[model samples]
Target: MFSERFIQYIKYEKRYSAHTVTAYQSDLDQFMLFLNNPGNADPAPEPEITHPSQISYHHIRNWMVELIDQKMLARSVNRKMATLRKYFKFLLQEGVIETNPASRIQSQKIPKSLPVVVEGDRLTEMLDSDEIFSADFEGRRDKLIIEMLFGTGMRLAELLGVKEQDVNLHDGVVKVLGKRNKERIIPVNTELKNLLKEYIDLKKNQNFDNNSFTLIVTNKGAGAYPAMIYLIVQKYLSNISTQSKRSPHVLRHTFATTLLNKGADLNSIKELLGHANLSATQIYTHNSVERLKSIYKLAHPKA
Candidate 1:
């Protein structure tokens, strides 16, 4: 039977991201609802067929074709295919199925799109430190958030997962819970340390008593949600350039690109970003190279 138990399995047992779990649920729920065949345990009208697990590769292919015919974007179609593939893989792993039908299904060929990142000067302009810190609590929190993002280049999820005790005020370091629940410690600079202290002082006056260990809190004193973080980043960075998509990820990309532009090694950047592999972090190098080509086009001679 379709249940929340599967979602709990993915979240607690497999340590999947909330976003990932939501997508998996959507994919599986879609299939389960459509599975009105006789053998299915779901209490739905029969589909005039038996053995729902007998859903074949053709079924998945048809689903893809249907979405495409419905005018879905290529990227959306690809993501849906990926979700179905993951669901089938999960079923295979759990011994509920003999083979993964979705595995044979090919994802649509999406063009190689470059990452949208803030330029180095704009990044510097935003994190100028003096301009960030103000007498207000919101100002202080904003300053700390920007500094942590630009400094460590941590993912938005990792940043939001930061705990109060994880930060070593004296040492000026933060312990981040990265992808796959991997823990990494990144040092914060003096400016960030001071700003964080001020923010904490402001937070204490609010008398928050939530059990969540998150560092950033909402105006209502609850821990920050993923969407709230994205909105905050978008509110600040929307004016810079419409060409560059603004999100917490852009701040992360800006962090890595700045480091690469300043000659930081790729491997080190990978470690800092908590990427599973160097290849994941290598996109920043492409951004850096593009920047170099732009400058060279304008500044170089003998053309």
Candidate 2:
């Protein structure tokens, strides 16, 4: 009952995306299952927890241990822990629990890995090479998808959520709805603006259902979903990049890294990428520093 109310609170009041809400729901369900069937998994089991109010730090620790024993990565386990922390905070706020069980729990320290980005010259070569992306409707749509990610540095979800009205060809700006439902306007390059206009015209000529107002659509005229977008990005990126991580996010990283390497201000890149904080955008600087080191090594004559 409490879980249902929390789900509703996040979905309606917090306005979290469906994907995020689903993740929270899954975390809660798993935790509840652990509480209710603690000893069922073994010949001798522990006592079952009957209510949220009865949960303590010990139970939370046992759950974390079980997750780690199952070989879940530290990053994933930390996300689940965050879900529990949020849930307990909600219970505390509603006066159903006197104390938060997850308050004292510490998240596992995760290694900092720099984002994988395709080299700028390689990406430009692939995009500019003739016949790489065909001229048909599907081809045009696919090309636009790649360009949109690399050009605007928008999240895949934000790109998929774009509606026809969100784009302003005349003004050369695209309105992106970002995390926590924050909206930001990102400028579109002249080349990409023309490509968007062409894609829009092609979409209109398809006579898609009137209810489908999304800017990017599947071949069947339905709005593009996450899986389809992933596959599209993966397929195109494989053509030019040998990196193991070649998803839409890599393109976003490429966009930001390219700008940073070319001397764009960090704050400007933050706004363009719709990052809520400057620190979130600072990771790209690591890429810039690496590039500088490479240039220095190649040019310096000292032994």
Candidate 3:
């Protein structure tokens, strides 16, 4: 019964990131697949059969070791561990289980890595790259999508989740579902608001039953999926980004970095990013400090 609904509860109720929910789904899928494996046991069961929830710590440790042998990165392993922990925690809270075996399972320590953000001119170029933004409906939609992500520092899911009613065009604000299903209204600058209005006008001429729900949609009028969002971000920015990962999250990072460099308070940035804690927002401060250190080194006339 653990379907996308449970995932949504984690997203809305627990305030987990879209990325976190996807990872949890993947890890739980893998664990379920492992449990359903009958080759290692007596009298193989049919495919898609459910298994009991009596997993041992040794089994989890073995799974971690297997992931290591498969050359999964430490960050990935740690994420899987976190997923298991969350799943068990949910099970316990729901009274589905008396104890969470994953409670003692320690996540692999991952080194803190600063998020990569596209630099000034590159960011401008990425935003201005109109080769993909033709004088067509789809092109205009893509451009608006990119602008919203880079402008708002919003997660792609939040952008895709935007409803027509949620936007206050008069006030130049857009309300987005932030982490834990919390609502945060972000101010849309004049330029961004103008572009969004244009996109909405174009969308008005399209056929869509769900237009009442989602602000953005595919050419087929379906709400944008997370993968589609990633592809759109990658299709536009990979050419301009110096870093290897040029997904929507990079645009989010760029948004945070730009704000911090311009003197936005950490708490404000946290609210904008919908982060549950200031610690999550502190990463961008590190990026700003590193850039400041570089600028100081380059400008100081120390002998």
Please name the candidate that would achieve the greatest TM-score relative to the true structure.
Answer: 2
lDDT of 1 at 250: 80
Residue 120, model 3: lDDT of 54
For each candidate in the order shown, give its overall lDDT on alpha carbons.
Answer: 0.76, 0.90, 0.80
lDDT of 2: 0.90
Q: Write candidate 1's Cα lDDT for 1-303 as tens digits.
A: 423656777789989877678887887676665444344333544344344367778777867787788798899888888877766676677777789889899888877767778766876676674654476767777767777887778888888888889989998889998876789988877878887888888888767676445789887778888888877777667655565478888888888888888888999888888889888887777777787888998998942
Per-residue alpha-carbon lDDT of candidate 3 for residues 195-268, written as tens digits (9 for 90 to 100) = 88888888888757766558888887888888888898888886776567888888899899989988889999
Candidate 2: tens digits of C-alpha lDDT, residues 1-303:
499999999999999887799999999999888878846344566566567888889888889999999999999999999999999999999999999999999999998989899987888787777778988789889999989999999999999999999999999999989888889999999989999999999888888775588988999899899999999989988888777888899999999999998889999999999888999999999988888888889999971
Clashing pairs in 1: none
Descending-TM-score candidate ranking: 2, 1, 3
User: Any idea what lDDT model 3 has?
Assistant: 0.80
